[model samples]
Target: MDHQIQRGTVVLATPWGVAAIFSGVGSQYAGMATRLHQRYAIVRETFTEASDVLGFDVAELCTEPSARERLNLQTESQLALLTTSVAMHRAFERQTAGPAVTHAAGHSLGEYSALCVAGALPFAAALRLVRHRGEAIADVAARLDGGMMWVIGLDTGTVEHLCRLWTEQDVHPVHLSIVDAPRRAAVSGRTADLHSAAGEFEARGAQVFPLRVTGPFHSPLMGPAADQLADFLTGIDLAPPRLPVISGVDARPHPGGPAGARLLADQLVSPVRWHAVQQRLAAEGVGASLEMGPGRVLTFLSAGTRGHPRPWPVDRYEDFDALARAMRLGADDEPAVLDACLRIAVSTPTRRQDTDVAGHYRRLEETRRARKPGAVATGLGALDALLAAKGISARERRGHLAAATGGRTWQ
Candidate 1:
């Protein structure tokens, strides 16, 4: 399929009961979507097109270590994440067979990818839009001394009360950036206010960790970015989304076009109701959801949300197997549908809440690479290649294979 074709996500529904989810910025890592780029012509062309629009090589940016690290910065992460997600979605569409996605949702930056999937925004336009937003956000961060902190072990009510308390105490503009799960939230503000709030929460037996970010994203502190973003969007005319896309601002499905633009713009400074979005999708009977891009964050979040829709992650090109399984299971087959339902009903499908995700996973990935090497050396694990090339023995050599399995490491 050409990039010029009228696309997916136009309020469209797949015969299968599924939702397409997108991963956000924090999910960025080196070598993201590399497998897709190497195996699928569409994925490679997607990055090539994005590279042209961004005036740099997006595919190389994802593959290169230093560039990928730069992508973690607010200015770069959003674009990289969006490009990878859109590329993956586009490639999936061209596949011979797969499950249909009835709904789509994205976390913060991921929403742009969802819109692209919805066909509301062209891929190039989406890339340009995210780049502009990132630049605006980076500009705001450059001028303002701000940061974000994750407050754990605290209820939404308590977090809200704390925000109110800080405001009352003259902390200026401290605000909740995201309600990640039931008791987990990310608060954004000036450095002092963020630390102040963290200290307060910690004193009350809550755990707080500073997010690896340069800006106070999703808070009133982003007003300047919002302004710049609105001006940047002045010339763009977004088409109506063919598929239903959820808005992080209010956790509601947006009906594309001007309304979608408004919702995206508002999300710049509004708290991302990610947990609520998960709940809404679950309530809508989205049997299973797939995180389209690298990182299992959304998959893990599924375990924390209100209902277990059985999130299958698609962090790598190999992760498409899970996507295929989702489509096949929900293929209107009574037995397969019942099997999935029973699996979800019987399993909690999540980890303990207090895991040191950032540190632990980084180390875990490093160790796995050291021990296993080959495709596992990169986050995209190609077991077939590993088997094809000397079967994971002392030395290694290989060619890229076609598969869609997603895991921080090989599943």
Candidate 2:
């Protein structure tokens, strides 16, 4: 089937909902997301929110020449990529008025972005978590001598066998880190060991290419970083996702709360099962895949998958319109009505220290009992009225709404 977009429409597409795929590190570049930032108010607001948490101008870092080089560093790169990916997703939602994401996934560091999109983590909390994660990984990389390489034209089984042989014989550790496609994988180990093994992979009819990364991520060598991240995550709160988020670590839906925290922390030392992630998406009945970040790396990976759910990259301004038309998303649709429980939840403050906690809960329960399970109003306009009547300030409205509604305001 033809996967390419022709005249802003996708051909041979399925009827199931879309899967949003967030880009990870190594996808960031100078001036990435500048177009979205310049054109969309939501994008600018996202960057501003990230800056408040990160204590740096993320927009400037992505666009400025001098600051762009900092993206090469793990800490800066991770934060920048997370901010940009989140911003792009928000912009896509507002601009396209598309169907709510049915599922979400990310590659490596992009998992944090996927969690944010799925409403498992608050935006500010995600930024702070990524900052600490980047720092922890950077610290580990500084202490260890490691690298990663891509091995194409070889199945994962063959690559795993080769890695096992090398690890059994060599002093340095070598492990399979990521399986991107059926026959494409990445291996990680000491820098010298990677270079030494490159010849063997090439000799076996596989093309070996070095990746631009600081450390051998997604391997046991990153145990210290995983520990550091686990400690940091314990203090943060995680909520259940509105939509399913496939984990790169295990290619399974994240079990939210403490279990999710453990999975995320352990992911640092776990191989990214991206091939399985794609399979999971297909099994979930995702009709199409949208890359909501700077580069088309995830798009390319999805394209390589056999059958169903064609991939599209929605990084540029025009991409949103193209994909919206192709998928016929939100076309001629009436405004979505909010449920009573969700309206009350949005109006309620998440902070435990808020005044009249018992009163809020009692009112929420009363509203839930009084109203049926669906359709509180013609649209979110009713929710806006409720928020205003409840005296929820404009500044807190977006965060409350996003948290309560899983960032899909249209839903």
Candidate 3:
């Protein structure tokens, strides 16, 4: 393929590149550099008590070292992560020309960033929430001594089965916290339990790595944190979202209803269905995805699902010219066709509700109908073949289709 041709499909093809910019946190770092004069205002202003307890300077954790260094401390790490992602989203708005953010979703603390992006909460309020969250985790980490770990190349089923066996063998019952893919899952619990689980997984042909989190997040152990955070979040005034935001706990699209913020607080103690988030986005026809922050973590999380073109890692590059080249899309060309296809698939009906699948089919049929006779024959023939693959009889539909094609018979 020509480097300029981009490596993917147009509408029904895999997305070649993301048009919209999804970002958070990095902008905050830039703003903090000028605004705070290296004071670390967000953490110092919000997490006063937690900062006092940790003895380490929260400001230094957030602004003194590099962005990657801030990520080392769970509290500062998550806060900076959320703030930076929000900043990136803003930067994207300044840079891109498109509809407002269609929908948003974040992993763990990134949920706050999503909400901020959607305008459900203010920047300062979100910072406070993160501060409290960090304090709660730091408190728990100090007392209970727990941590989080990532396991690669194992499906949830296998991980759950292994965890059960580990529990039977006197190891703690670690909870599956984040399911990023069919093969990648993160678990959380006491450090000892995690260590023992790592040993057991290593024995079973799996790789386990520890995360830089202070507490056993998204587990029963975090119940106390959730309860406290719930009180704080619920008491605050959280406006409805201006844009769509996905729920990390359920992998469902949150409608910015009354319960949105409450659910966010509850997320602290619930498993993050990250796998579902990416799958749902792909299913819904998101052609191109952009990972906003420093690392390619979200894009990495989305690797297994179909529809989305490989996610574009956007950083360092000042503009999207490189990305557009990579995706093989021109400024004038409609966004990738695969993105449209994904939208069609995702918007398609389900047993619980009527999806727009019929609409998609109608649109495709119309486009084929409008094509030249020769082209219609080829397209209908392809549709017939696809129907056959699904064991559906297209004979009856084929006749009507042939008549519509003006005797341009396929076969």
lDDT of 3 by residue, 1-411 (tens): 011222432222221112222432233344442233233344244434334545554445555545545566666666656655565566556544422345577777777777777788787777788878788767766877888898887677898777667666766678788787777788888888898788877777778999866678887788888778877776567788776577877767665544776687678777787768765654443444566665666665566554433466655444434433444433232222223323333343343332343454554455444553233223433443333333433333333222222211111
- All candidates' lDDT scores? 0.67, 0.73, 0.57
lDDT of 2 at 300: 76
Please give the RMSD to the true structure for each candidate, in Å. Answer: 15.3, 15.1, 10.5
Residue by residue across 204-317, what tens digits does model 1's lDDT show? 888999988888989878998888887777777778778778788887878666676777788889999988887777556565677788788887776745453557676633
lDDT of 3 at 64: 58
Please tell me which model should have the higher TM-score, number 2 or number 3.
Answer: 2
Per-prediction TM-score: 0.74, 0.74, 0.65
Enumerate residue pairs that collide in model 2.
none
Error of 3 at 325 (Å): 6.6
TM-score (C-alpha, index-matched) for candidate 1: 0.74
Across 1-411, the per-residue lDDT of candidate 2 in tens digits comes to 113345653322222457889878545456557667777899899989988888889888887778867877778888888888888788778888566678899999889999999999999999899989988898999898888999999888999888988888874458999998888999999998888888888889999988988799999889999999999999988888889999998889987899999999989988899889877776665656778777788777866467435676775436576656654423122222134335455546544344454454455445444543222212233444345456665434433333233222222
Model 3, residue 71: what's the lDDT?
A: 60
